[model samples]
Target: MVVGYWRLAGITSGLACAAGALQAQLLVRAALGARHTSTLVHDSIITPFVLRPALAPALAVTAATPLDERWTAQVTLDFSTSTLERHDADGTTTGLGRVSTLAFTVGLRRPLGAGFAAGAGVGGLKYLPAGETGIFRSGAGGVLGLAGAVVSYAPPRVGGRWQLGIEARYDVHRFITPALRSEGFTSARTVHRIALALRAGRGGAAGAAGAAGAAP
Candidate 1:
C-alpha cells in the first residue's frame, strides 16, 4: 500500500510542473497574438481595462529667467515615445500599440539650499499613436491638461557657465479613449507618470556664478 501511494505522489508532482510550463507558454503566445488579432477572447462585453506606457527616454528643452535670488521662472518642452501596454483583470498584459507623448510646461523653481531645487508645473499632454488600432480605434485621445512636480540637484561648485544637473519628475492625468468609452468604460482612469533624467544647461539658479566666472 505504501509503495503505491508514493508512486501516485510522484506522478502528481510531475503533472503539476508540466502544467505550469504549458501555462507560461500560452501566456507568451497570447501577448504576441494580441498584436495581430483583436479577438483574443470574446466575452459578453469588452468592458473596462487598463493601458499603460513602458519606460521611455525623454528629450527636453528649457528656457528660464531668474525671478529673484532664490527663484527662477522656467518653461520646458518635452517628448517621449514608447509602446502602450494593456493590463487585464487576470494580471496578464499585452502590447496595445506604440504612442508618442508631447507636453509643454511652465513652472517656477527655488533652491533647497544644497544644490537641490524644487518646482511645480502645469501643462497640456498630448498623445500621438503610430496607428489607430487597439484602444485608439476611433482616434488618439485629445490633449489633456496636466500638472507635475520636479526636484533637481546640481553641484554648484563644478562646471563653467553650463551647470549639469539631475532631475526627477512626477505627474498625474486622467486617461480615457473614444474607443474605450464606446466599449462600456464610464469613467476615466487616473494615470501617473514618473521620470528621472540627467539635465545639462543653465542651472536655473538666480545670481549664482559658475566655475568659469571664478577662473583666474
Candidate 2:
C-alpha cells in the first residue's frame, strides 16, 4: 500500500510540473515601419530650434513571454533613419543631414480586450550620423536613453498558424546632435510610428481557447 501511494504521488507531481510548463507562452513578431519625429533643439549659440514633422523608416523585432493571461514581459529591438533640415532667417535651407538610431527596450504588456494590447518600455539608444551637409555636421556618435509605448491589434486567426496585426508606437529619446553639439546644445526628440506584421508562436492555452471561441 505504501508503494502504491508513493507511485500515485509521483504521478501527481509530474502532472503538476507539466501543467506549470504549459502555462507559460512565447510570442514572436517582426515588423517594418515608418515614424514621424518632432525634435526640439537647445543650443548655447542657436538658442532654441524646432525640427518638426520629419519622417523616417524603421524596422523592429519583438519577443514576449507570458507572465499570465493578463500580462507579459516583452523585449524589442528597433532601428531607424531620421533626416532633418535647418533653415536660415531668410527661409533658405542651411543644413540637411540624416541620423540613424538603434535602440533596445524591455517592458510589460497587457491585453485590452477585443484583440488589442498595450505596453510600455524603457531602454538605451545609439545614434550614428549617416550624412551631413550645409550647416549640419556629423557629430561623434554616442549612446542615450529611450522610452516608449505600444498598442497593437491582432485580427482573428483564419485557419492559419500565424496571426496578423497592426501596431503603433510612440518614443522619446534625448541626444546631442552633431550640429547642436557644434553650437553647444542638446535635444530631445519624440517619434510616432506604425507597422503591420505577422505574429507567430504560442500563448497561454486559455488565451488560445478564448480566442478560438471568439472567432467568427
Candidate 3:
C-alpha cells in the first residue's frame, strides 16, 4: 500500500513538472525577438491564519530565481500544523491530539508578462520528529513522500516596496506502522491548499530600472 501511494505521488509530481516546462517553452517562443534579460529574483512569505487549525502559527517562505525572462526556479519551505484538536459541538476540547509538519519544495515558474507569472514544481519531504507518535514509525516502512505545486506571482511595482502572489499546492504524506503496531497506521494524508503572499524590499529608481532591464 505504501509503495502504491508513493508511486501515485511520483506520478503527480512528474505531471506538474512537465506542465511547468511546457509553459516555460511557450513563453520563450512568444518573446523570441524581444531583447530581455533572463533574471528576476525575489523572496516572500505567506501567512495564513485560517489555514492554521490550531493555536500554533504557520508560515511559508519562497526563494525564486528566474531562469529567463519568463522562466524561474523556486525553492519553498512550508511550516504548519498537520492536525488539531477536534472540538465538540459545545466547544469542548478532546484529549486526542495530533502534530503539525514542515515541508521543503523546489519547482519552476513561467511568466505571462504584464506582471503575471505561473509555474509548477515537485518536491519531497521527510516528516520531522518521527517516532512512536510521529507521522511514521521507525522501520523500513517509513520513508519520504512526494508533493507538487502550481503557483502565480505579480511583479513588484515602482515606488512600492512590496509584491503579492498566490499558489495552490497538493501535498501527499504517507504514514505507516510496522506489523507489530496496530493502533496507528495509514496509507497517506493528501490535501490541497490555497495561499496568498506578500514580499517587501527596497523599491526606488535603481531597483525599478534594474527590474525593467532584467526580468520582471
Candidate 4:
C-alpha cells in the first residue's frame, strides 16, 4: 500500500506539473495579445450509481471547480448503501452490509479546446467504513487516502452560458476494511455527468456597480 501510494503521488505530480506549465505558457501568450482566447471557469456536481447482477444500488455526489482554462479543483462526497453478498457452496447467503466514504481531491483539468478536455488529478479519500448493521461507524475501515485521475470533454461556449461535458476517472484506494487494512485496494471508478447554468452577475459587475477605484 505504501508503495502504491508513492507511485501514484509521483505520477500525479509529474503529470500535473508538465500539463500546468504548458497551459500556463499558452495562457500567458494569449494574455499578451499574441492570440485571442476565451477561458472558462465553472463548477458542477457528480452523481454516481451502481446496478449489477447481485449487488444493491448505490449513489455518490461530487463538487468540482475550474482552476483555469485547463485546470480544476474538486471535492467529492461519496455515500452508498450497497453491500456485497456471497453465496456459500451449501446455499448459504451472507451480506457484507453497506459502505460509504467522503473524499477530498485537488486535481488539474486540461482542456483540449474545441469542446474537449483531458487531465489528471490526485487526492485523498476520507471516510468511515461501516461495521455494524444500519448504523454509521467511523472506524469500519473501508477506503482511506486514495489517488485518482480524470479525462474530460465538454461543449465549447463563447459567453459562459450553457455547456455539456463528459468525464471519466480512475481511482486507486482501499476497498474492504476491518479484516484487511493493507491501505485499501485499488478500484477504478468511472463517471458520466452533465451541467447547466446561467451567468447573471460577477465580481466585475459588482465592482462596476459599486464604483470602486473609479476614475472621476
Find the candidate with the highest TM-score and give its number. Answer: 1
TM-score of each: 0.69, 0.67, 0.50, 0.44
Ten consecutive residues with minimal summed lDDT in candidate 3? 29-38
lDDT of candidate model 1 versus the reference: 0.63
lDDT of each residue in 106-195, candidate 1, tens digit only: 887677756777888899988888999877889867988889887777676555545666777777777778887888867776677777
Residue 38 lDDT (model 4): 16
Overall local distance difference test of candidate 2: 0.63
Q: Model 2 misses residue 113 by how many Å?
A: 0.3
RMSD of each: 23.4, 6.2, 17.9, 18.5
- Which candidate do you rate higher for TM-score, 1 or 4? 1
Give the residue spans of candidate 1 off by over 4 A.
1-49, 88-92, 203-216
Candidate 4, residues 1-216, lDDT tens digits: the string is 999999999999999998765443321000000111111111122532221113222232333444433454445433333443444444555554544444555555455555444545555654343555322232544445556654444444433422233444445553333322233323322222111211121221222212211100
Worst 10 residues of 1 by lDDT: 27-36
Q: Rank candidates, lDDT, best first.
A: 1, 2, 3, 4
The sequence of per-residue lDDT tens digits that candidate 3 reaches over residues 106-175 is 8776655665555566665543432344213444244446565544444555424334333344445443
Q: Which order, best to worst by TM-score?
A: 1, 2, 3, 4
